[model samples]
Target: MTTPLEGLATIVGPGNMLTDPTDMAPYLIEERGLYRSSAQAVVRPGSTAEVAAVVQICAEAKIAMVPQGGRTGLCGGAVPAGLDRAIVIATERMDRIRVLDPVDFTMTVEAGCVLASLQAAADEAGCLFPLSLAAEGSCRIGGNIATNAGGTNVLRYGSTRDLVLGLEIVLPDGRVWNGLKSLRKDNTGYALNQLFIGSEGTLGIVTAAVLKLYPRPTERQTALIGLPDSQAALTLLGQARRASGDAVTACELMSRLALDLAVRHIPGLRDPLGTPSPWVLLLELSSSRPGGLREALESVLSQALEDGTAQDAVLAESGTQRQALWRLRESIPEAQKHEGGSIKHDISVSTSRVPELIERASAAVADALPGARPVAFGHIGDGNIHFNVSQPEGADKNAFLDEWPRLNRVVHDIVMGMGGSISAEHGIGRLKAAELARIKPDLDIELMRRIKTAFDPDGLMNPGAVLIP
Candidate 1:
């Protein structure tokens, strides 16, 4: 008779079992510092088979198990908070590209493969794996699929859900569901593979996936535009898309406060425009067929300027300029960190109502906290705004942070009234689980509970997560 710890160690090998507090430090914490959890051990499994074996042992011992990816999630989805009687099943060791079929436009990759690495692999194969985000350099593919991640590219390529052709998941009770098929069309009976795609590791642990790939873009046009307001962004997006034959891949909206913080705090970053505007939009168009993209972009941009759709614009002449423009958009969250305590909201309304959402939320938060600065920015292309509130100048960070709950209600009430999502791109990890339970309809909660029960009867699989314990 072997103990559960011994059993796990035997399956993954002793070295892969991190039992020491020092060795397990990295795995026990969440990315946003919201959760500092305790895990009995951290086991790294190099393959799907090893993961399966580890799960089986945990199930037999009645031990709770948390399936972890790169831990890049801001929400506490990967954090096993309050589940101290658990072990973290880290997938970092299971990284391997099983297959890359350029002809079929698909790649079979293990869960631990870093997203940027996969993107580079696709690029090397003369294809595009466009599920890119700021954290692509370190975030693993498994977490992306698990959260159904939406990034700057989602305006064009869609989210992680769209990019996945199929998934291979390890069930709660140690069963492996091998649905890793590369086919684009599979009218199979239940579409069970879709179950775990955005399940956030609650239903099951994702071990591998068949990811969709697109043709590599031969030409790209990047432009940062000054906008009069959020409504103007909507108008410009529609006009640009229609004029450019729907080549708009990304359109990010940034508020003045957001751009100002980025330019001021982020070293070596300067505002590209001569005159400042209330809002800025980073619009990018990419096409595999070259030669006409720039002309079309320029033509529409010129028309936009004349028609008052755009106030001012700066088109990237080189890769360096393109990168500089992106740094401004990407650095907003980091810049907010420097300003002190910040409360974040990853909310989304319909694409048409983005301006309303921004306006209402901004006003609501300001009235709630008069001096608080609103930093509104994100994928305006898809209606998802990272509505974050930076503390008033020289404010005590922790004291300001204490108002998170109150400010959340102020903004969330506005979002809910607009028929928008409280957690848009970021999945409802442990952090938002209670709010999700409170605001969602009873029937919606019931259906999700039933699904959770069907998949994880014992509640040992990531309990206290999306469907909180």
Candidate 2:
């Protein structure tokens, strides 16, 4: 007698399917290590047709399926939830760049293509694919689209949802929906590609995508400015945008604590400013045209300082220095892990209200757990902040982690009060599903459920992910 997964193996070929637990370990673990997934096997389908065949086998058996891409998501969206049997449909074997049309300014790529590779392909074509993130080298385009990922560049270029033109998805009942059109102005009917873009794999599996491209920036300027506080940082962002003619490509914020942790943990990474302030803004300006970017950025900083919005600043004179400055910004998460356990919130508010959200949330967390250090940092230009709290010195890791729920509520309530989103950039995977239900309007959630039902009536696509059953 053979197992049900053995049928799936026949479709993907024996070499592409893994039944041994050791062989499947990598696919079964979430990036944060907060959740461990249990699956009957991990299937690697090589193409859209192969993916459809595998889905058909699983659907016939009524076995749940989780669509995985690179598995670098912080939300645990790709990890299987329950003890019930399931299989992970890994897209690694489907990695390919199917089309690159510089004339149309678009690239059609398989879902498993790594983000960094896609950017490189666009660069080679004298274009730019601007959806960047810390996990670009490991995260796949499919996952980025699934979560509607936003990064530093979101202030200018927008999120993955904005970058995508169309997508190819395998439906719940093994039907393939190829909506991969590269046209920019298609208004024929309902924009169906969007339905799966941020659905977190609950609706269907994204197999490929047609992504929009942009003219590559030829001139660039980066600066690190020290601010009195988050309020000052917000003000400086306005100044930078106005002074630079709205050419600011990135504006990231970091608390003094966040900077200190990065400096201590990451070697060769040092604070560019001689003296530290309560908050710092890592601002970058870019243009396709050459010259004057440095001068424009300098003028912005001069005005910010003269107006008392900035206390001190350091403009990167060389590419090496600019990279060093970015390293300090990107290394905060790894640094926090080294310090102790951390409770994190990826929340976003209106740009004007960021200061209040940070100030009140920090005070609230500190009052609840004395000595808890808040490391607030991220894309301030777009109002998404990675507000994280490190454990107090000498506290038990597990004990500190157990306070995740209480701490989350303290932060989320303040976010909701400010008309902000609790899960910004990161999708509401299993972690935030309950919080989403509690906070979201009943009618809004009901509409979402109806859409989910229409797409996946059997609910086999990534069960127990974004929606609670």
Candidate 3:
């Protein structure tokens, strides 16, 4: 019987196969250093043809194939698990910008195209691809679509799924399903791309995609507003939307604890407003029409302050200053890493339930584990909050981690009770597969399993992810 490594080389060529464990070290582990699995080999396929060939070889050999993108994924989606003989199908080498149509306002790019490069290509053509994330500089568009990434701009532009016009998927059985369509409207059959948007590489591998584009904003306004709490932030978001109409692009909320960590840990970063408040709301408005955006933001902010909803606020006077204000908001996640080990809960509820969700989750966590610090923050405009808990001061790291499962149960229970999702923006990779199985309705699980079996009956694509055995 031929070895899995040798079988992969036969399809993708020996040059693309890495069998030595030392050279495969990086691909064996995940970004967060949480889960590690040994791969028999790592294959760097250069084209969709190569990917299909590799998949066919693996399926014939009864070996598992893990589809990997930029490796910046927070979930263990790209990470291998279980004792199955596996090979990672790395897509980085397939990077290419296939087509850019300024007239039709669309761009067709390969799965491995870096997210930042795609954004730059759109901007050069005087269009905007607004799926902005801090990891955009390193993350690939394939992983973004696979995870259905949600970032700050989601308030105005929606998630990656919203911007995707079409996709090219490689099925588990090594069949290349070329479903790439760039049209704006297609009243055809069911939208197949939607199935793979947040599938986490469970059903198929995304090889290329057709992405939508929008008119580039000519005028922009940004503000740093001080509010008393989450309740005030919600009120401010409503007021800003009322004032700016459709130009309200971003409304991000940051807690005082979040800001403190940014200042204490991250260098060259300070409060944007120069004064500390319990909470801050970063607001932005963009328009195709030039001028008056700053005035419009100021007018809305003035009303907030008069209503005692805002203590103070500042507007960016220039492009450089605008980026500076954004830098503070973007630095929160990185700055948080320096603090210590943390338990993260990316969840969302109805827009009206923001304040209640924060209050209930915080109280429950504190009650469950005494002295656990809540570092809750994120896109309040979209009803998603990263409800994180910092370990108690000087506590045993492993001991704190030991409580993770129970802690997750407490938090997730409250989330479900309130009619909220356990996993919001981030896809459920290996981390939450079991929890997902336990909590989701049986019919839902049965349907998902049926679909998985239909597309991947042999189960060659990212097995042990998004499903329980």
Candidate 4:
């Protein structure tokens, strides 16, 4: 008499199946404390075949399945929810770079390979894999593709969706769809691979991907510019892009409050500018063709400074200085944690309307939640601003957090009005499922539901994710 658990264990090997509460604890937890759920067991599948086998048994047994990757996802997409007796298909053991075709400029990697390891592999092969984010160290490639992650490099290289040439997905029915071809153009029908990229595992589990790589950057320039506002940041971004022949890699906008929070909390970080400014722009440019990048960047900054578009600027003269400037931009989120109960809204409008979005959102937050510190910052070049609102000084943390839903309504209303996405980079996990349903038109919601039902007829694949049941 073989139990379903015993069958899954047999498929992945007994050592890979974790049923002990202590061993399964980490897998059951969500990145944000917002979601927490239990699983029958966590099965570490080591290959696409193994993943398929596990899914088959679970499907036959009518056990719900949750596909979990690195578990570094901020949204609860990877977390098991809305079901009891569900089995967690963990991908960590499946990590292996299947192929590194530097000549072809594509790397076929398993879904479980850590993002940083892939970057290093690409760099060693004399190429660049530019899908970078703060969680690159621990986040896995599978989850990145699953979320269609947009990171710092999206300004230039585009999102994970753009970097992916192909994907191999485990369909909801325990079948493996091997679409891992490296070809740049294959108009062979519905583009099935793309359907799973940003589906957040509701459609299928991403098993592996053929990732696009670029020529390694030979020259780079990093600078921190003190700007009067986000509008100035946008102006400087356009000028720098034109001057550098669109070599601009990252254009991050940080508010005074966001930077101040970083400087105040994170040690050894100070404002790089000589004078205090209301906003700061962290601009970076990288190119395969070496030598003239700095001069081009300097020329743009020179003009901006002369015209008063930029108040003041500090260009990183060395690698160490570059790290320092980046540290300021990257550390803002961590610093916000020190300040109590920060509500984050990862929203985006058109690049041209970012300033107006910030202004309108800030005003809305102020009116809705008086004394809330709206830390507006992020990739202004791509129009994704992380409009995070910190709690009022001395306000109760839990109470302020209780206001998250209210504040979301306030901020998201304005964003929707301006034709912006409520969840830009972060997909519609459990966090925004209801909100998505609320705002999305009935027809749009119907289509999404149709897709979910068509793929996951049993509602077994990552239930209660992107589409609410």
State TM-scores per candidate.
0.99, 0.98, 0.97, 0.99
Q: Write the per-residue lDDT of candidate 3 for residues 92-205, one digit (tens) a residue.
A: 988898999988889999999999999999999999989998889989999998889998889899999999999999999889998899988898888888999999898999
lDDT of each residue in 130-211, candidate 4, tens digit only: 9988889999999999999999999999999899998898888889988989998898789888888889998999999999
| Per-residue lDDT of model 2, residues 159-271, tens digit only | 99999998999999999999999988999989998889889999999999999999998988999999987888777777778877888899999999999999999888899
Model 1 pairs whose backbones collide? none
Clashing pairs in 3: none
Worst 10 residues of 3 by lDDT: 268-277
Error of 4 at 25 (Å): 0.9
> Once all C-alphas are superposed, what RMSD does model 1 give against the true structure?
0.9
lDDT of each: 0.91, 0.91, 0.86, 0.91
Q: Kindly list the per-residue Cα lDDT of model 1 for residues 1-469, writing each as its tens digit.
A: 7899999999999999999999999998898798998888999999999999999989888889888888999889887799869999999998899999999999999999999999999999999999989999999999999898999999998999999988999999999998999888889688888888888999999999999999999999999999888898988889889877999999999999999999999998999987698999999999999988899889878988899888899999999999999999999998988999999999999999998888888788778888999899999999899999999999999999999888888888888888999988889889889888878899999999999999888999999888868
Model 4: residues with Cα > 4 Å off, grouped in runs: none
Error of 2 at 154 (Å): 0.3
